[model samples]
Target: MTDALNAPGGLSRRRLLTAAGALGAVGLAAALSGCAADDPLAQQARAGDNKNYVAGDGSVTEYAKDTRKPPVDFTGVLYDGTKLGSKDLVGHVTVLNFWFAACAPCRVEAPELEALHTEFKPQGIVFYGVNLRDEQGTAEAFEQSFKLTYPSFNDKDGQVLLAMSGMVPPGAVPTTLVLDKQGRVASRVLGQLERGTLKTLITSAAAE
Candidate 1:
């Protein structure tokens, strides 16, 4: 989980290969576990596992069907100081990315994330970032530098993180999650995103 994903040169060939392998591993595990949406909320049985993410390994995990957890509820102050809560996203497939101004991988994926925000905007796929560090000006500067339009919450005190409680705790600096229409945790990418995989994940969630 601690592997460096996007370096100064951007996603390396090794990272690409690792992502492919990770996807394969996730698929295999899902298949073996018969994990589907029939009772997605069954995740309650795995509460012990939700303690924290182990590390960043560029892996993607999708909890579709019976394996998806219930919609998470939270409220926080956005970077622009707007009041935001999970209820507002009930009907849409939303993307939540955890990041900060100083993370190299965060900067590397900013443009790509903005692209996803734009591409999915019309489809009702909203993207929001959760700043794990940095104050307003610092986070805003990063957003401006990347020309990102979506609003990010400045969770400097980690209140937003605490709100997550036992479910899908963002364990790494650049974790990305796709919340389904019901606001449930649908899928998560544990490191710097692969645009195609994320797009596919979000698209699938939107369609569902």
Candidate 2:
């Protein structure tokens, strides 16, 4: 897989992290290394690639909830007090990112996430964030510091967080979920992702 990503016109997700390391970054190594096949993050990525965000039996593994819809609807709040819900995002390809302001890993990956959001948003991919285990003011401050342009939901009590199958267990910060236009959980990327990998996901989901 590393070889494949390093091939011509290919972007090895790990290699990208290597370059990111020279810049004195944090958590990029764990984020990228864990993304390899056989790793927990990689398993989720493959499941998503196979359109198995919902398990083989059509059930969410960690969470007991089952969905009749391809993509389940979610509702919460933006950092600025605006409402965010599945209905608000109808007819769009949405990349939902679960994060927390206090998580160092999440903070480290914010720039790259923001970059993907900026690059693909104009192409019809919308980035919706779920800020978990933090106050609205803290989440809002993080957004301001990062100059984040995408809208994010505040999961202060973790009710919304607990409800998300892919996001439950809270194993890691900065989990990503790609929802197709028809509202299916097309891809689930656990932990942070490289810009190239994220772009490819957005492109594929938008095409669907």
TM-score of 2: 0.65
Instruction: For residues 1-208, write the lDDT of model 2, one tens digit per residue.
Output: 1132343444453454345434323333443432132344334443454221222211111111133235566678777778767776668888888877655445545666777777786787788888777677787777887678887887876766766764334645557766767666655566545555555556656765
Among all candidates shown, the one with the greatest lDDT? 1
The 10-residue segment of model 1 with minimum total lDDT is: 36-45
RMSD of 2: 11.0
lDDT: worst 10-residue window of model 2: 56-65
Highest TM-score scorer: 1
All-Cα superposition RMSD per candidate: 14.1, 11.0
Model 2 Cα shift for residue 160 (angstroms): 2.6
Model 1, 1-208: lDDT tens digits are 1212432433553465466556644543342232222222223212223222333666676664566666788898997779999999899999999887666556556666776788889987899999987888988877776678999998878877776665445557678888898888877787666666687678768887
Residue 193 displacement in candidate 1 (angstroms): 0.7
Each prediction's TM-score versus the true structure: 0.72, 0.65
